[model samples]
Target: PASTQRHVKSINKRASGQAFEVILKPLSPVSDAAHSLPSPPKRDISLDDIQKKLEAAEERRRSQEAQVLRALAEKREHERDVLMKAMEENSNFSKMAEEKLQLKMDQIKENRDAHLAAMIERLPNFHGPSTSLHPTPSFSPALTLSRADTRPWRPRGGGPHRHITPPHTIMLTTAISIISGYKHG
Candidate 1:
């Protein structure tokens, strides 16, 4: 009965310890050691042939890189040319606008002078206004300063009214009352 108890205690100790056994074995696909070596290449292939193919591939890759760089440079150059052209056009347009304004001012002066001269000629005793306001047929320092007709506009250089003026200017009106001696109601 003691022997039977001892056998039960041994079985319990083994179950708690949990020891395991292992067995090494080769794979079924590679059972033969001789089959593991790789096969040799045919006699027709050589190191020179492989080297030539590698060099050709390298040359092709270099040519592709060069083409990409050339395309990028061309794109940059085209953009620069477009920007320069736009700036030139803007400068020309501004110059033309300034010339137009000067021409308009000169035209106004001409019309006012012609009208005033005609009205004053009709009167026997017509006194002219101050030289600063209007210029007469005679030459004066004030007339010379305001005169634009004598100095013609040159596109290359030496343009009339080079300075900027107000877009809206006050123009004098012809006063018929001064010439006719008539009173306003």
Candidate 2:
């Protein structure tokens, strides 16, 4: 051991005079231990450790993919629900509009009927001799048409074709025309 240990010489200088100094120092213990000790055995990586890490990474990837799929499904569901709600609202609006139109149409029909009845009730007020021009015409009015004196005629140069429509016929025609015109209008 003594032979294996290494030594070095040292020198010193004084201001008074230059002196020769003999000193022997052995090698430091840290240097000897560095050479004597073997490096720690290299850590061995097992196949199971690498496989476990890969499996964990794959699991994490699958989990992330699942989350993305779930989010997409939820988004589609929300969109579908919104579309259905809009459609329902549109349907309700259409129904309400149709009902309102129908109600207005019914009111118009009632008003037309009332006006027609009022016109029909006023027919008897027309002036006619023995032909009152009532809603229910009497046979006397028809007889008045054929009578010699009541026969309608317009003297045109005293010709044979001087016969014209009777007063009662004219009144009846006016009433009919009024009814037909009201209906059409």
Name the 10 consecutive residues with the lowest summed lDDT in model 2.
127-136
Top TM-score prediction, candidate number: 2
Cα displacement (Å) at residue 32, model 2: 17
Clash pairs, model 1 backbone: none
Candidate 2 runs further than 4 Å off: 1-42, 125-185
lDDT of 2: 0.69
15-99: candidate 2 lDDT, tens digit per residue: 8778675656567777788888777999888999999999999999999999999999999999999999999999999999999
lDDT for model 1: 0.57
Task: Report every candidate's CA lDDT.
Answer: 0.57, 0.69
